[model samples]
Target: MLADGGSRGLLRKTFGELGLLSLSAFLFAFSFPSFISVDGLWPLVFIALIPIVPVIHRCSWAAAPFYGAFYGFLSYAVFNYWLTTFHPLAIFIVPVIYAVYFLILFPALKAVDLFFPRYAYWIQAVVWVGYEYLRTQGFLGYPYGNLGYALYKVLPLIQISELTGVWGVSFLIALIGFFLGHALLFTFEYDASFFVSLKVWFSRRKAALAVCSVLLVGTLIFGFVVMRGSYDDQRPWKVALIQHNADTWKGGLPTYRRNLRTMIALSDRALAADEPEAVIWSETAFVPGVDWHSRYRTDSERYALVEELRNYLADKSVPFILGNDDGQKADPGLPPVLSDGRLNRVDYNAVLLYENGKLRQTYRKTHLVPFTEHFPYKKLFPGFYQLLVDHNYHFWEKGTEYTVFETDNGVHFSTPICFEDVFGYLSRRFVRNGADVIVNLTNDSWSGSVAAQMQHMGMAVFRAVELRRSVIRSSNSGMTCTINPDGRLTGMLEPFAEDYYIGSVPIYAERNTLYYHWGDWFPLVMLSLGLVLLLVGGVRKIVLRKS
Candidate 1:
């Protein structure tokens, strides 16, 4: 399999280009919150894609996909460096998926640049938004690194999220990136001094100005007006969010016992400080499967622990919400168990609501973390599934329904377990289905990275504005906080710390939020527009060639 001299030369050139482009991605990665600075170097975002533009424009159609994948992997790998902490395999797996995505995107960017040089950047922005929409769909959808997430603190700019979800903000930001990127390309095209090329770029700014100005000004105007309106805490319900600071990866009776005690201590202190209407605990705050152990009594020790939890729940005056493993027997009609003569049982990562000393309702997590949490389709991806299984990955069966919980005082809400809050559609659905607030129960203590925690919380901010629903994030060990409808995060507790937050979570007056009714129409529109432009470009190219 040794390559000849010519092939080796090509390989060397390719690796050299890849190494160079990764430096650009690294520069852009600092635009998001990280160890570089918690409040990211936001100004860099406007020019982050400057280096990417020239490559796509110069590369041939045959070479575009390869470069696209190269860009995807490097950009994501640097931005999501925390994936390595999650699992050694995750850093590669997550970015490689993006690589496959950019294979389509990169070629299209090049094709559009070749055919329609004048409006290439504008169309490219639309295409980028479309790609983000595609990436955040299906089982593999992780809406973490979208351009909109970087501007979480920029209230005026992100106000567009109400009408267009995060897609609109992404489109605006991406357009800016492309506009600035094209300016750098202009310098090379002119073969002139940098200052002279800069002046020329500014003079020919009609397209970018026309699009960016109207959106930018209108966004700020809307934001200021909206911000001025008082968000009345008229329908307020106090909730105590408990962060026990537990390492979720560690399992067994000892760890479980310690985490539970910490949660109780925090909850008691919160109750003492303020009489919260209810208490919220992070995901898997209790490790033992409550329903399964109480019913079947699989292990005597775990069963005893479940009994203790039941007694604690019974004594609580107000409703208590916590995350646990909800286990049930698998159907005989399903595929044979991976177990060798073991109990044919399936477990769900679920949030349970207890009132009057009884389990009232349960919401099983719908969106599972791809390979780590749930990996089905064994026949199609046998090797990958086996690889995951070999790594000791325990998969959970996907839950089909969205469950809404109601407290004794008639406070209606839904708990979107863990990363579920990061997805816009889930929060919209919860609000649509009569959930007054969105409460997220998450356990991210295992990552051991504050940057990772901040990244997760940053994405959740958009869900609040998109649906106009108050969002409460209660996590084990960090990022426990509440977000208002206007996207202002309040009471954001320290990451990876044992703490509790009691907040007056608002229940907005039931009114039709535009995004809730429209769903993901904005992104769909962008995707359609991108397809149409590419189709037009193909037709134009063929017509010109034939003539």
Candidate 2:
């Protein structure tokens, strides 16, 4: 009877703690762009994870992993709920997969807390940043929704991205959250006076707290200095971005034609206002078969549409950077067999530059979306490829080169198609290869959510700040805007609106940034430190066992 009562009591306690952890996860999720739409609420991110810290500290090491996994599952599921609009299956699968990440993360973090109890706060920051860096690696690496992105509106705080990439900002947030959590736990949970609790906390964590304070103050001062520096003397070039809110996926041929004409009309209206040097279009704006090579131009319907756009550009006499499809014939050496038993010719999602109605430069999309664009390990599983084909998925061949386009007026830019703009290293590569500005062509029509578009645009802002280059983003559904070198959003177009924006972006002659030269070194160093700590821990266990 006593054993049964004890079992029930333990279960009740477990459930109660789980409820508090879930609340913490909810707070964390709400700190992101979707739930907390207002810019000022960004500071809430510093306290979002505080609730989870007590739960972690109170739980046994064996139970800590489960708590961490559950927290991750709840947090990511809420933050990424918008993905369910595109794929209902993702609601279950995405959270489960992301939860596995925290399963590994919490155990490692628990080990740190056990080994270095005194410096747990600082070590926790390192572990969290290391995990974030790991999340951005390889085929499944998705760096979206990192805590740093929440600080996009807090421009001065985010300037540290130039030195430490997004990982540094995430580390600062985690450090502050841990410190505050410790203070709260000491005061309320331990029944101590606030001043006494704070004093105890400061005495125990003086080194970590002092170092974090120095870093915070230094970063803010550096950001203020950088913000005050003038880039006004740089040459400015006027550019027009057009957005035609069309359901390109569902609305068949008729919808495509209407969207194209609407884009042209909007461009015409923008030109009437003032003749811009170049007019930009969103990704996949035209029907397929607009390749630079003539051999792939066999489809008459596609050819006619391409001709119409070319004639319009020629008449306007403005250089156009428009997104379309390009193709090349299958190589005799090696070619993929299609679902229809035909030799697969390579297809590319590309952006083309047109001057006087003639194709001048073609930049194919390099980083394709994981599942939607191309399956990563298809060669290992033929059945997966067949399943994708059965569902009418169009997989694209990855482009090889980092191609840059030069306008007639000698302005240099590189176009990162779709969500490729989210990648910091990819954008840095372009700037290193002589790109003065970063132009992104994207189609966010399928999302059908303003929050998704805004979230995407927010990440792109970091790219501009990291490279000190102007970023021009033209999206099919919305968020057609210009981000200046300082990461300020200007000339923003409304989502789901058929409109255009004309803005002058400064083109600095010199492109110099520490991040542009040394990419993601902060995260790399954190990852290395984590590995060294693990090695040391393993060695210590071995030494103790032998003794």
Candidate 3:
């Protein structure tokens, strides 16, 4: 009986320690979102200071790994809770995979701290930022839910990203975390003689406080100046985004007639209130198939449907754009079998621009989704390809070139479908090639949870800030909105419901962001500096051992 009681007590203590470990980690990561929100500046940076207080107390290097693990689990669990929908196993599995970053982060941090005792915490903090920068780049880069993304709602602070990308804004937040950590540690007492004890150090603490005050003043001044200089009066055009909250599962031919009617009604309402020069609809709003009026038993049925759309726009006299599937007879052959000995070949997903009831331009989606839209091993594994096709997951051939649609209003816009807009370099290519604005058509209905919608929108804000261009995003199942050049959500529609809102997307033509001009070279430079510090620490350790 005593043994059982002892076992329970031990378990309780272990759980208590773990809970503190989690809380300590949470303090460092939790306030990250507020850093980029409409919330004011100083509090976001203040929370970054708390984690270092425990580390500086006795400096137990073992706590670093525990801190890392706790922080990683909390961050991923909160942000990526939607991964469960992709596969039932992902709820536990995704967090385990993401935890590797923290597992690597802390041990490396403790090693740097042990080698460079004078500024070990600062050095570790800087290296931490370098690790974050690396994770968000490269071909396998998944930059979703970064700490900087929490600040997406904070316009004035994020304006600096125009010069440095999201990595730059992340670096600034990291710097604040490290500085606050240092100041907290600076407040501690020293173990020495009466002359060199904390009583005297308390007097010297005033100097440290003064230095921190100066840093605070400098950051505010720099942020204010940058915010003021970011806006340009010489901009280009205004775009209108139409968000039809449609469900992907219910988005087949069965609901085609109803979907068309709802969208037309919304467009008429928008045109009535605030007539935006250009209007856009979400992805896959129209499903194209080979039935071709055979089901209706009339040759003019297909033509009539298109004519209905044309007549509606002509009546209002406004240009319209929407997503549709484009497929045509592949070769010069008989009805069923073409020259390729297959059925009618469909050209994947495309955006159709209708101006004055005439088709003006068509831009096909270039980057296909990895597993959902296109299978990676189609040629190697024919059976897998057959499974994907049979499942009706529309895998389209990727477009070879970037197509910028020219509007009658003299504005050129580029289309980024779904996750394609999340890439910094890809978004850069469009703006660099003379695109006035970036339009995103995404369908988030497959993601049933709110976290997935917010995470996706978070990535979109970073692109707008980095490019210094306006973004009009139209999404299925909510989060449809427009972002100004500085990454503010100028207008937004609610998610997971059937609704539409009209708002003007002011187009800006600034091509002078340092990030746009130079790419990720600056962040790479900071990373190189961290690598040098790591190398120097290793060499110093070797020298000390030899001595």
Candidate 4:
């Protein structure tokens, strides 16, 4: 009977532990994007403190998985919910992968505590960040909703991100969590014995306090440096961002013309004014794949559109860059039309740059959206190709190389579409390729929520600092703005509003940053430390038993 009662108590404790995880998830969801940023309740982040309190007190190794999984679900559900709009199955698969990371993280934390008892929080924070770093590395580096993005509005706090990449901001936040956790859980009443013992033993409070003070001071110093940086120059460049509110519901060529008209009209008005040197448009604003404008049997309709666009730019005497599906040339070694007549070819989604009333250059997107642009492992299961079609998901051929275009002033530009700006490597490459300003042409109307837009915008901030190059983002459903070289938002357009927004982009030659050279080093070092601790713990256990 006593044994039975003990088992019941264990089950109850497990369930309670799981409940704490659910509360954490709820707190995270509430404090994040849609609710916190959009609703303007910035203090909700502190409210999230409620759930984090218990985790520090007892340090639940077993509950870490449950908490991680729960928070992962809540995170993706709200932030990447746009994935589901593309394909419903993604909603399930993504969260499962995210939850698995949490599962791995929690048990590992418990194992580390065995060796680094007093410094478990340090180990835990680093290991967790290392996992996040790994997620942004190789084939699976999806760094969406990373805690670093939470400081999108707090430009002053995130200036250190330029030196450390997103991991720097994440490290500070994690350290704060560690110090708070230790403060809540540890039992030390400052007895005379304890006071004397302090001479021999290091106090966790002193160490945590020191780290916190350093971080706070470092952040302030970084902010002052960024603010005083050259991006604060007030030189104006009469820039224009065209909002072509295209309908994603329709497919094929008919809707493409309608989308072009919307962009063209917006461009006409943009040029009607001071005739800015360059004007930007959202992704896929034009369809140049057909026999349109090119010398090879140009269609009358295409000729007319090109001529009209050229004339429009000539009349305004300004350059325009827009997103379009410039279909591919007949390439050998690639498959022809499938049995369903869906061209297995055609590299869609290319950003065409028109300068001085002529097509100057085009930058094809390199990092295509997973499942949306390229199906994962379609070669393994040919059957999934049909599943892609049934869901109306478009599979565009990936771009082979990075291309940058130059303006008359010798300012080179590279354009990334949609979430491509979120990829730090992609932006870094642009800067490496001699791009003065990074222009991202994206269409986020499908997201249908301001929370998702702000989150997307937040990720762009790191890129500005990473390359030390200004970023000009032109989006269809809001958040069109220019980020200075120091990651400061100089100007912004309102969300869900349709109007031409203009801002001057500071042209600074890309300079090398420490983070741009050696990426993810901090997290790598921490993960290595965690692994070493675990190994030491295992070895010590064996030696003690043998003794």
The model with the greatest TM-score is 1
Full candidate order by TM-score, most accurate first: 1, 2, 4, 3
lDDT of model 1 at position 45: 73
lDDT of 3 by residue, 405-429 (tens): 8877677888887788877777888
- Per-residue lDDT for 236 in model 3? 40
Q: Model 2, range 313-357, lDDT digits (tens) per residue?
A: 776678888888777666745434455767457789989898877
Runs in model 2 lying further than 4 Å from the true structure: 35-40, 188-196, 292-297, 332-344, 383-385, 509-511, 541-547
What C-alpha lDDT does candidate 4 achieve relative to the native structure? 0.69
Evaluated with lDDT, which candidate comes out highest?
1
lDDT by residue (tens digit), candidate 1, 1-547: 3568889978776776676567668767888887797777777776777677888876667888988888888888888888787788999998898889888888888887887798888899998899999999887998887888888888877877888998888888888888777888899799789989988887898766776788778888988887776578458888999988887548678989888888888988999999999999989899898998887787899899899889988988899999998888787554324346676688899999999889999999989988999877789999989999998786887888888899989899999998888889888888888898899999888777787788888888888888877889999977899988878987878877788989886788466567888988998999999999999999999999999
Q: Estimate each model's TM-score.
A: 0.94, 0.93, 0.77, 0.86
Instruction: Kindly indicate the candidate among 2 and 3 with the higher TM-score.
Output: 2
Q: After superposing candidate 4 on the true structure, give the runs of residues whose Cα lies further than 4 Å from its correct spot.
A: 1-8, 39-68, 78-86, 187-204, 230-236, 248-254, 288-316, 330-344, 383-385
What are the Cα lDDT values of the candidates?
A: 0.84, 0.80, 0.66, 0.69
lDDT per residue, candidate 4, 1-547, as tens digits?
9999999987886666566656655555555566445632333443343344444334466566666676567656665665665457777767777888776766676665555667766776776677777777654557776666767667787777767777777767666665455444342334446445453333535766787788778897878876685744544355799876554336644566676667777777777765677888888766655222454323566666655555666654467788877665555454444557555446667888777666778788877877667766778877877787787777877787788888776668889888888887788787777777789988777767777777788889888876777899988876788888777788888877767876787777636787667755666787787677778877997898999
Question: Where does candidate 2 have its weakest 10-residue lDDT segment?
Answer: 291-300
Better of 1 and 3 by lDDT: 1
